[model samples]
Target: MRVTVSQPTRRGTRRSHGVRAPAPTVASMTRLLPVLATAAVLLAACTSDAETPASSGCDPALAAWADAGFSGAIAITAGGETVCEEGYGDANTALTVFAIGSVTKAFTAAAIYDLVDSGALVTSDRVGDLLPELRGPVRDATLMQLMTHTSGLNGSAGADHQPLWRADAIAAIGAMPLAFAPGTDHVYSNAAYTLLALVVEEVSDSTYREHAMTRILDGFASAGFWDGAPAAVGPRAVGHLDDGSTGEAGDFAGPHWALDGNGGLAMSMPDLAAWTHALFTGGVVSVESAAAIADPVVDLGDGAAETPGWVARDASAYGEPFLAAAGGGGDVGHDTMVVWIPSEERVVAVASNGGDVSAEELMAAVGPALAAGDPIPAPDAPGGTVDPDVAAAIVGDYRLDTGGAYRVSDDDGLRIAALGADAVEVLFPPRDAAAADAVRTHERAVADLLAGETPAGREELAALEDEFGPVGGAEPAGTIVADGELRTYATLATGDGPLLVWYALDDEGAVSAVEAGAQPPALDLVTDGDAFRPADPAGTGPDVTVSFAAGVLTVTGPDGAVTAQRD
Candidate 1:
């Protein structure tokens, strides 16, 4: 899928790219600001559990977070006992409420399953049965397809700039063509789940919030739909950007109700823990319904499977089987995750308001340690130098087969520039005046393509080469790959770090496919800022060695190395 620039909102909205904004007062904070002085004293006395040491089962996970300087709250349970409950960094209390983002889907999913258990609906029911207004192929989508994100709906249909009623949102969804045939493929769609929320309302004859409150949150905890107006909840944590920069208190804003069913849920760690406990223990739904909620009916192709609300996969730390669910939002500057090991009755929930670090990384670090029941050693820090000769071979201007060119320079470390109007518009979104105009021009071209004015979209894109000249700007910090194929990694000028540009060479050594923003997983390499180095100094990976031989420069890894011929 092509990557698109995402916009920010007052309420947390899920987006692929992080959105930077001046901090706004969150709903919870706004509601509690008047009572802050009094709440601080009462909260301090009530939060002693937040400092409790992890039981033997959770000690390693706690240690891992400590080692990584993680700023978050964590709660771990084993065999129905609390093994660890703690907070770190700015998230110094268990009562810190986090914008749980997509994790809200779990609650929404559970509500759907609850209705199923009550005989109000079934996974096999066609969505059209519930709402007759839905048009096109989407009407044929099963409840199961929506649960597993295979409903053929677009992941998102632009931004929800203002609050929208369920009917309005459904109408918008019905107007868009299906991205693909329903049930044929898995494409994550927040809109599909939002439709599920509408289904819940239609069957239960209750608002989505009312159904969720009574069925999912009532007995467990007081977490509710974030309506932008704070209810009487506990203290709220300030959200920080991914770079560890905190937004100002003045920036806390209200909820974006339009994101209902897909995201926009918030709660403290304890409440989150309670919610997890209820779902796994059949407290919220019957054992049979809970099982169905995590049945792994669809393969996600990444060694993971999708249940209604969770991703079933091998635990990264021990390769043990576990069900995991995660949610993150750049707009809210928060990430949250829950891991449930059914066999062991173990649950680990982590939530972070800081944007600089990902909850997934924190979970990955904690999972193995928790599973091992021992602290896993941290990977070695990155430090090494790329050979100048190897770097020189890959540094040059190469024209993209599609159109335009990119220049790689070794002048100040390695960097790449998106040259020409078309490439710049594709690689970078509208940020400044010239780039904004380019985007507008590109949008007009897209309108022409959509109108069938050109034989193909590619033709319109190629026509740009004649109409516009090159626009150049360099991204700092680049890595040259000399393994099997030549590739380079560099930070984009937009501040999103490390996009890989790959070059496929023909038999004559001419660059064949100049694909940009294609990155494979890192091989035994520890990344520190923009640089990479062998995770194990003594490891035998081919990437640990760089050599020049037979007119080729190679940066080798264990299985393979990227190589480029000397000019």
Candidate 2:
């Protein structure tokens, strides 16, 4: 779960090959070992959620990012004023709202340049003559290759709140199969923005959320779309999760059809800082539809490119260049980001309805300390609180010295959070005792090693029948532990299909270590000093350390330390 959204948007800087690796499996080597498997990185398990009392124009780096626990809602603007609207914990940067995922594809690329400045639509319109029950090649893509995501359309026509409508999301993108051809290459289509909200409901006869709240957010006084059972009353915010709990709040202002016009908006933070100050100065759509919605030659490499509702980049961290976009916590817990900055005409915009900071990590922790007035760098303090009898003396079972076996118990935040419903990690200190086990015994030792029986401590395992051939049993999939080692999980059914595995038993329960294939693992963490170390989401982890004291526990890493005790 090494997630990353910014550090110059990390997808391995430029993947010509950098971040692909894996293939040699065993559930990708036990998810490359999350610090020996306590499997870290799943934060949102907050300790700070209610703020706003500081005053004197709050901003000591957003109160050291809500005293390090983190949470969101910010505003910022510049050219025309408003340099910093607040809200930190429970988020109220002026009344909440959130759910702005996929930053609604830069407002569906600014309503296709506000429907080509009212001439209705162009960009050489096509999608087979405006939605004619689309058939293949993403119905001959055009409207500038579905407004720059390069329209070979392949990212999905379903499952983003799949309630399905708009003729079953245009018959599921006219029955898939074209991840290529259309304007030749680029892919990130939410079914090409749900066919550009069904080409703005077939040329504005209306309803793609009423032509995006009256013509691409008409005057923008609180932006629109997102009804989720909303007749109106205001102060939204529900969201939370990442361990924090309560999720999805928008309910549906949505012309549904899988979030129409791609990832529906809910907005608010002074209407995303007045729609990034009316889409960079000259007002929303004109100078040739905002220069074809700001350049977009594609690239999307480290210098970034692809335009249409944002992502122009150029190495910011506040060193200039911007025009970004981000939306909710995948799996919907809510988060958003906007950023504009055309040479400081500025606009920052960050949103969250809980799951601690992540609106591009609170716009990279408050846009370069509010563009250098400086103060937001606080973060390190959370590596110690667990008293209630030292979390009942560090829960139970341990064993280690090396033979591996740990099963501590007590952190009742109930498992199930492998993350992404607004990811963040690092919430330690809730009276510890966090157990976590229910063995499928590595799916009955991968169904007795697919019936050929060789599962006794893996017996030099590794044949994967010529890299995976005939296979079909084993399923379970859970359990991890690490340093105080456990592993377990399952899946297999191979013939080149499902794979994913990870067995382990040692301390006499037998089996020892099994390994197998297919990608898996996505989670969170953070805290270092007396030794606690994983705060990921790219805050960087894996040096490993962990601690505990009197009853023992230890951990260390690079495969060296270990410890345990508590039996």
- Model 1 residue 515 CA deviation (Å) reads 21
Off by over 4 Å in 2: 1-58, 66-75, 82-101, 121-129, 136-172, 176-189, 192-194, 197-275, 279-282, 285-336, 339-348, 351-357, 360-380, 384-474, 479-490, 493-567
| TM-scores of all predicted structures | 0.60, 0.34
Q: What is the lDDT of candidate 2?
A: 0.52
Candidate 1 on 356-433: residue-level lDDT in tens?
A: 234444443333333334443452333455568756765665554445454545664543444443333333332245
Per-residue lDDT of candidate 2, residues 1-567 (tens digit): 121111111111100000000111221111111110010000100101222224423344455655454566666556756655677676745656666767787777787777778888887788778888777767877877776767776545654553667787788788766656877766555667778878877887776777777766777655675545322235766775433446555564343676667676776676777776777664766777776677756765545567775656554322445556665543356656565656546665667665434444434433343344444346544454444575566666555543444444445411112211011011111112222112233335444654556533242234554566655566554454331233544555767787665544322122333345422332233335555455433232334555678777665655456566666
Candidate 1 yields a Cα-based lDDT of 0.52
Estimate candidate 1's RMSD in Å: 13.3
Residue 47 miss distance in model 1 (angstroms):
22
**Candidate topping TM-score:** 1
Candidate 1 Cα deviation (angstroms), residue 41: 37
